[model samples]
Target: MAYFTNFKMMMLFTLFTLTSNAVFATEVPETNKSNKPIPEATKFVTQHKGTFNGKNLNYKVVAGETYLLDKNEQPTASIFSFDYLVGDEKNNRPVTFIWNGGPGSSSNWLHMGGYGPKRVVVPSDAAHPGTAPYELQEAPETILDITDMVFVDPVGTGYSRALGETESKAFWGLNEDASSIADFIAQWLTKENRWNAPIFLLGESYGTTRAAAVSKVLMDKHLINVNGIIFVSQALDYQGSSPYVDDNIVSYITYIPTMAATAWYHQKVDTSGSFEAFIDASRQFAVDELLPALFKGNTLSTAERARIVEGLQRYTGLSKQYIERVDLRINAFRFAKELLREDGIAIGLLDGRYKIDERDDVSADPKTDAAKVISPAYKAALMHYMRTDLNIQWQRKYLNPSDPALSSNWRWRTAPDGVSWEPKYVNTAPDLSYALRSNPQLKVMVASGYYDMVTPFFDAEYTLNRHGINAEKIDYYYYEGGHMMYVHEPARVSLLTDTRNFIKEQLAQNSEK
Candidate 1:
């Protein structure tokens, strides 16, 4: 699928597509004919037996597309999903719909690296996945015994695309994306005749954002309630997670603990005390001391400012002089570069433990994420699995990371174009709150990585601790890895264990009700 921003190219492509092949339209008028004669939804199914969580079972893998239709029953989009079904017990079995996050991302990351039956083997020690011929190992720890899984790829990703006169941008906005996925879920349930099954949502990164919004959409629009939601590296509130903006006061406070953890991992800070104790102290300092000092700004006393700077230095392992120069505010990306600057290395934002020697040592931030070294192996493994194991013979390219066109044309507004509205950080925490209130039985599990600078563990706490979200309904789990914490083997096992237990607990409660 492709989108042409240039008028001449769009005209040329339109002519070419009309005569030769069809083009996937993005932001095109309803009158556009480029996407005419949409092809049939694709499908490939296979069966296998696998052991998960000590239970051996036979399962069917349905690698297929589910087309979503409009109000008039016209095909609007084709969402590709990989469904792993253990048995035909639809009424009793729980179904967990999963996806990874980039506003434009496919489900490949979580599919090939985290919860799928097979995963690409990368170093668990935070080292780069060196080369190809990477091992694809069985991930028997995934919670297949307790629940079925569906990994979905939204429009313009994987083999999914806009159909007929529908513009790809129709599914690219925050609300649009969530609504489409909700529609897909409804369609999926009806198609599989599994509408009565208990449903769960598991999402990572922006997928977490989507999950919250999707939950609200499901309850309000579809009149369907999800049993639980699992947020892997929760990013519900962007204010806390975004460390790029200079004046984001919440971010300065939210990232302190993650920075402390990173400092401890790199041996940049004192390791004399217990790590957990130190993290707790860092959190305290952030809220109690640092938050006040940053808020006071020019009114802060010199002595108090000095004291806060000392605390920042102690927690972040940056020098007092450097902390003062930055006015006590440290951007996460800058910290990644400055932490090991003397060693001519830059750490990753996704996983602070991963480091790389960059050619440009003077840059303010890393040229690229050090943790992304495992991506190629993941993509390769998924492709191989699809072809060999699932018997998939599709020619369409799978947008693993995400499609460039989707990213470029993504809409972030909650309102339609031309609507008068003030812009704010993208947040779906309120939507989550609404869902929880509407569905009193609903619960959430937040899984965080100590070293994830992108969506700091502390940020998750800050975001979820308020906005009328009940504290007791949420369960928190911490890991020793980074953004994609499952990349670390121990974290992977622990995460699976936690997720499995969470699902089982939810089911137990469902039975009681």
Candidate 2:
């Protein structure tokens, strides 16, 4: 769940190996038709009524599998999606396609915790959500009243999987994953007869990376134009988010504000001033002071290095010795463990507010994410809701994160095999820039959490602000919680309100055209 840790490093390493070897399997596997006939794509349709934003509306929930085909029109994979559409008005209303990240994730996190009509209740105060029987409450705050929703679980996650003959690894690469999602969107639009409706892409974490790439694919390949995109905890450029890597100067700079925010949350830093002001100062210090000192490396003078170390200490609340020990570049994971080390507690990387007392306080980084305290509740709620509420009776097991093979086989190479390419951070911000350039009317809303160490708010700023993206078309919204900011009540309400308004604003602009 954290950045470029072992799994991510393996992904990167695999890409490097593939590129260096300059070899790939050029043959697409034969269509999988075994001794037993492939089961028909399963689907469950249910009708329900609810009050959303004070408006009583009846909606249909279509939870099922959509087969993705090869160029020969043979089924290659099945993508499972949950479609929520207003009664009979599915074609006319705006539609937003949503997914969570993991590169191998199910859409369940955003589905159950953020935008779903029925959200699983967890402790908003960052406490453990305790055992099961988790409450499923009506999320009237969701923006469903204005837009039809499609929550997609990419292949290898949820009930989605590779069909006969096609291997799951076929959809486990950077380009492969985005292409499948784009294909699914086109297929969904065709099935629902909603090609004319305003389309939006909403993705969180690595899903944000998918959104940007998908937007470009939709425009360049499908001739489809998205009206807007919402990036929840954006990770379009991995360089800014990959803090675990050594000598990654961008990460050192990008993570300062987040560390400052975490320190402020734990009251490790001086908190007398406005939190916003402190964050602003941290951002400035990162760019103006720390970045240059880190860049100077061994050339930096002792006096200047000392001043920079003091600034880091002031913002990060880490001691001078620790700052010097790490050579003034703080690894975010260590910060999470060190911030509350004396108290025998480690703060959560996903949400700094959550703290756990680990058995081995000696570890440099937390063994597990403390913020994952709510995961069990979310998992239970989704499984229960699918069967009981959505009537999804399919026997297939739902993979929450993904299949083990997905991560192992995941490819990150950007170029075709044997193209003489070098490994680099996986970035899709340029794709988003291309999409914006192609569709002049398209705008983006970036929602970032102050406490999200996984994808820092400052990194979001660092990413979108560059990449030739138009600042005027990009709107930024900040939240109080971490990666899944909606877990915080106030943040959840504000996120939905901001989302609702952003969609409306985009639609309004469409009308004037």
Candidate 3:
């Protein structure tokens, strides 16, 4: 089995991907291809450049070798970084360190999909749940304009390879991952000579968790502090976000509000009486009635519990029987398939808005398969466009939305007895009080999609509230989309505008001080 290596070219191509919509402001259709080439221009190309979606751009279309060094400088694991420098290098612009989740996922999706130089073209009616000749188009709003981005794929993902099993496992644990990514950031900055530039960590899904841990590690361990951190659909404190146990009912409580919002957007639920009124009412019910009722446990009378379940089913689109059996607590998986089970369809896990009635008909897992169905089309279009139009190519495997190794156990530093003790809940919230006590310049912004089911916006909001970030400075934005919100043109343009504004503000604030 390959450990982790050769990711430069693969990581470079992550110029677009999945999640929330309505935040992006770019509405142009395949208007341009990226102008940046994959690094190591000579690595995999016979031609100097090519076209991507009829747009002129740069590309490094071949695999450029990267070596991983250990203590005393021994080759540890082979790894790489996809370098897409935004702005003029002569000026030494700020840089954003970007990544995706899945303890094992490569940063490709986030790189390409959300803030990258290239983005996928989604129809206006993105929530319709259909497929298309999806393609990657030039993205003018790539966070690149303000910050040069280095997208990374950890060991075992993309083209990263370790020396052997022993060295490989070194990168497989939680602490290991933190150390590895922190080290990578240090090394990348040194190699790129951008140590003087502001550093920001941007992550999605598990990457959100990764960013949180990395933020701490970078501070305490690496001593390299970042200017700002962006948690896209941030996911931290797994116990609060995931439904792993019975009391996991808390996860459902946070998710209900988000589900209602998405349903309202698609007109799947009754919003005739005023959508805000409806969601506000639901939120109130959740905070007041549902959460209290669930907390009471068996204390509630049978009729009371029944009434709560009825409300939950009505709002969540789940069956009353199923809701009752699970005590009104259901995870994303159940909702992904069961919500529309009568329609005989399972929704796409990556993008909840996508749906497939029959797995056999699609030849892929309802959750995973739908990604495959749409990804190839988008990817193929991306490859061709980036190579031909952008004229950039570093021949390494492009990180797809799917990677098997992502399922590996990377959360580590477990005790000898197999008891892992990471401060499950930081007794003190990770807010300005915690992170900014030493550095008040640190302000946090959370970009979320209201329709997102994976890391529901409400859950993220709840988590942030727990962190003690000042409600005033803590900025939150919601797109009318799910996980990878920029898939739609409207969202993409709006998100870009928001990103640009945020970066400008950060820079202005830094300078003013």
- Per-candidate Cα RMSD to the true structure, in Å, reads 6.9, 7.4, 9.7
| TM-score against native, each model | 0.93, 0.94, 0.78
lDDT of model 3, residue 315: 75
- Give a tens-digit lDDT track for model 3, residues 1-513: 011111211321121322211111111121112322122212222122223234443322222224444554444555545666533445668888778766666665665667766666655445442455565565755655466677777877766756432346668765577667877787666655777788778777667666766777777766877777776776765545554345576776787887677556545666668766877777877788898898888899998898898788767766688788877666654566666666677665445666666654332223332322344445565566445543444455654543444444443343443565553432213523365454566666677776666567777767777755666556787776666777666776777677667777878889998
Q: Which candidate leads in TM-score?
A: 2
Local accuracy of candidate 1 as per-residue lDDT tens digits, 1-513: 011112211211110000111222222123323546767666777778888878988888888888887776667888999999978854458999998877666788888888999898999998878887889888889989899999999898788888887889888888899999999999999878899999999999888999999999998899999999999999898888767789999999999999999999999999999999999999999999999898999999999998998999999999988898999999887999999999999998778999999999998887777877777787788888888788777788887656667765777778877889787888999999999999888999999999998789998898899999999989999999998899889999999999999999988898898
lDDT of each: 0.84, 0.85, 0.59
lDDT of 3: 0.59
**Which model is ahead, 1 or 2, in terms of TM-score?**
2
Report the poorest 10 consecutive residues by lDDT, candidate 2. Answer: 13-22
TM-score of 2: 0.94
What value does the lDDT take at residue 293 in candidate 2?
Answer: 91
Off by over 4 Å in 3: 1-68, 86-90, 127-134, 164-166, 318-322, 359-372, 381-406, 412-434
- Give the Å error, residue 67, model 3: 4.6
